[model samples]
Target: MATVSQIWPFERRRCLKAHGIITLLFLDLCLQCVNGYLSSPHVGQEPPYSRDAQPVITSPVVPSPSSASPTDSDGYAAKCPSGGQCNRLPADCINCSYHHNCSYGKLASFSCKAKRGVHCTAESGKQQTNFSLSITCQFCWQLDLSQYRCSNSTSCMTVACPRKCYNATCQVLDHVHCLGKRVFQKRLYCNWTGGYKWSTALALSITLGGFGADRFYLGQWREGLGKLFSFGGLGIWTLIDVLLIGAGYVGPADGSLYI
Candidate 1:
């Protein structure tokens, strides 16, 4: 019985030692499994180490056009300059009357010889003002009254013209001859009178004609002395001179055009 008891104790001790070694091996395997689970990547998330390497996202910017009107340095719109004016003709104008319709501004009007059938027509023109660089465009229509446009050829028939008068030269006709001519075909001419201001001469002649005042005022020194000595040609010269002076026929001794 003692031998059997000793053998049973020895076998029990060996079995206990084997169980302890197995337990230690099982614990080491569990630790390895936990470490592998933590190191693996998640299904829908990036790895922590790769976060900073990703590129940043941004929206692009676009520019828009400007919507503003142009203005001068004075903050005002450009306009016509000084001494600039326009004159529009009447609707019923005829017989080359349209030629008188003109506009005068910073620049002079364009001139072209008129053909027999060709006549003046309305046209547009550009005028510049000192205030701005932009141009001032005007339609061709009105006549510019600010300018004086007249020539000697066209001055004679203005009063008798079928159209409006731009310039006319009228002379006095002899009373007897004028009344006798029924057709009045003859061209009337004004009596010869000095061009030295009819008003001034007439005033001086009346006030001092006997003293040769009219002649002296007309720059006629020799005629003035003769009239003064002749008592104005015994008053006959004074009467004739008064009539002649009233007419525009007589011009300045210097032959200069009337003012």
Candidate 2:
């Protein structure tokens, strides 16, 4: 066996070497753990589910108002009618629409000077001007009929009656002629007899003047009440009402003349 001192020194050296190897292995493990933690993706940041993300921004598309076309009250573009003197007629008839070949704007007013009709009148060495536009003037008979006369009695017609008169004959009585052979082609106005009768109204006024019967018959409710309450203005009003009704001065409440 070796001496005791020599054996003690050898064992001491082996213990120190084992301790150094363990220390080195521990330091290497610590360094590897630290490097792995630093290399991880989520080491210093919060989780994606922790908070709300910002929204992406983009430009909005909008339509231009000026790109839309104009429309009328009926939801249609106003266009001129195909036929007649629509080009010469007023723009108000169809909301300012005019013929494509027309020389002037449809809304513009022109003189009726050379135009053949009763509307054209000579005054102060100038032709009369027309600003009032009428659709009736587009028709032939409505434009002028001063030269024609109805051969039948005037009492046979009413304003509400149809244009066709089987019993009446339209004859050219004057030298002037109407355009488009409209002497009998279009409507003709004769004596107008309304719903109320003049003779009946006059009789009622004379007979029941104190009771307002005539006013009631003529559709004058307010006047009827006045006459009834005031006792026909103490008879003086009765006489005056009689004369007025007979003279055709007092008409129907509906603005229609008595027959």
Candidate 3:
């Protein structure tokens, strides 16, 4: 019926329709792969995205990816990675972690199956590496981290703690992940020694001891009563006073070592 030029319109329409269908199918396949389903019926192919998302901390990485682990002037220890694959994370990771940009390059294909109580913290804030955030992990039972905090009066639930305390009296305890999956009651306390001042503790003891409270507060139950019975140990007990002032030990209620 029609001239050669016009005759091809119908055929061209069919070709266009076929192309549109193929494009739709391709996009659908890509979507499935990005969603992390990995196994889609249509494509019958494995997903290319990794679902295991790693936690990125505010600290960059040990040695900037060019050198060894970041070192302290004293070289006592090397800086550890805040979370995982540091330095390799996206630059905006700090701002992106809590939102849609968590996966960065792998966003389309990567899905995180984090357990709330073990890996993630309920407290909203940035994660820090210089200041190690201490947390009490229930361990094993749950696949995520829920609540993590430093028991110090100046709580560190959300803030990154200092790298190290100076002359200030503080406790440093090493976290132990024992039994391969359980947290143990056992903790190694870095008892303050050598030369550190405890101005706050001294002030509290001297002012509060008149009521026998200071002695009791410092884990000297017997000494507290003795001091209470003896009126601040005015003269005779001055010798014991020296001992208490210099001695560093663990707080009874808490396992933290105090100076």
Candidate 4:
């Protein structure tokens, strides 16, 4: 009876240990199932709970139409019609450029002088079918007509003169009365200021006439040498030169003007 009682007590201990182990295993399984059910639905999605919603405030500043920037047309003093006959009147002229819109394959023409401060308009329009319109003003050079006009109001014919002419007087050189026709030839002469002064020539002729000082001063080297060797042609040539120089009959040899 003592051996049987010891064996029965061991069997009860074994059964209690088994029941505790099974209870622990079952509790672990239930906890695992509850955790998987909580996290499985949101595996690839955002959390269901979030922060509190906030009101978004927008900017109140806005651009007004009256305060808009100005364009190029605002600076222009006038405007021209597009694809029509241009106004030739001075009152219809613009500050510089007359803007237009041109169709493709058609030319837009306008006249403007660049030297007068007129400029070519900037091209602005569609690329194809409609082309940008601009009128280019070329630089022009104008000749003064007053320089070619005569004092008598008569037009002067262009003539080749080696000596530059200024304030010329026109005169008829020859008139031919042949048959029934009259041929008139005119010539223009300038007031020439060339040659030595008559006063100086006369003074030299009176003072050193025998030595040919007057002739040398007048650029007549050959006459000067002749007078020097001939003793002023026995003093007769000297006396004649005094009269000739005073009468303004003598002139410079080179045919150039005096300083």
What TM-score goes with each of the models? 0.28, 0.31, 0.24, 0.30
Would you give me the overall lDDT of model 2? 0.53
The true-versus-predicted C-alpha distance at residue 2 of model 2, in Å, is 99
Off by over 4 Å in 4: 1-115, 118-187, 190-195, 257-259
For each candidate in the order shown, give its overall lDDT on alpha carbons.
Answer: 0.42, 0.53, 0.38, 0.48
Cα deviation at 15, candidate 2, in Å, is 99
Question: Model 1 clash pairs?
Answer: 87-142, 87-143, 102-143, 102-144, 193-250, 195-251, 195-252
lDDT of 3: 0.38
Q: List model 1 lDDT by residue over 64-156, tens digit each.
A: 112112222133212212223112211111111112122322332322221122223332333321111111122221222222122234233
Error of 2 at 202 (Å): 0.6
Q: Compared with the true structure, what per-residue lDDT tens digits does model 3 show for residues 1-259? A: 6888997998999999999999999999999777766444675766687645443423322222223233322332232223443222222121111222223222121112211111222234444322212222222222222222222232211111332232222222223210111332222123333222355445556566555665566566887788777876764464455346545332322323444
Who wins the lDDT comparison? 2
Q: Which residue pairs come into collision in candidate 4?
A: 194-257
Root mean square deviation (Cα) for candidate 4: 39.8
What's the distance in Å from true for residue 239, model 3? 4.4
What total of clashing residue pairs does each candidate reach? 7, 0, 8, 1
Kindly report which residue stretches of model 1 are placed more than 4 angstroms away from their true locations once superposed. Answer: 1-196, 257-259
Q: C-alpha displacement of 248 in model 1, angstroms?
A: 2.5
The Cα RMSD in angstroms, rounded to one decimal, for candidate 1 relative to the true structure is: 42.2
Candidate 2, run of 10 with poorest lDDT: 96-105
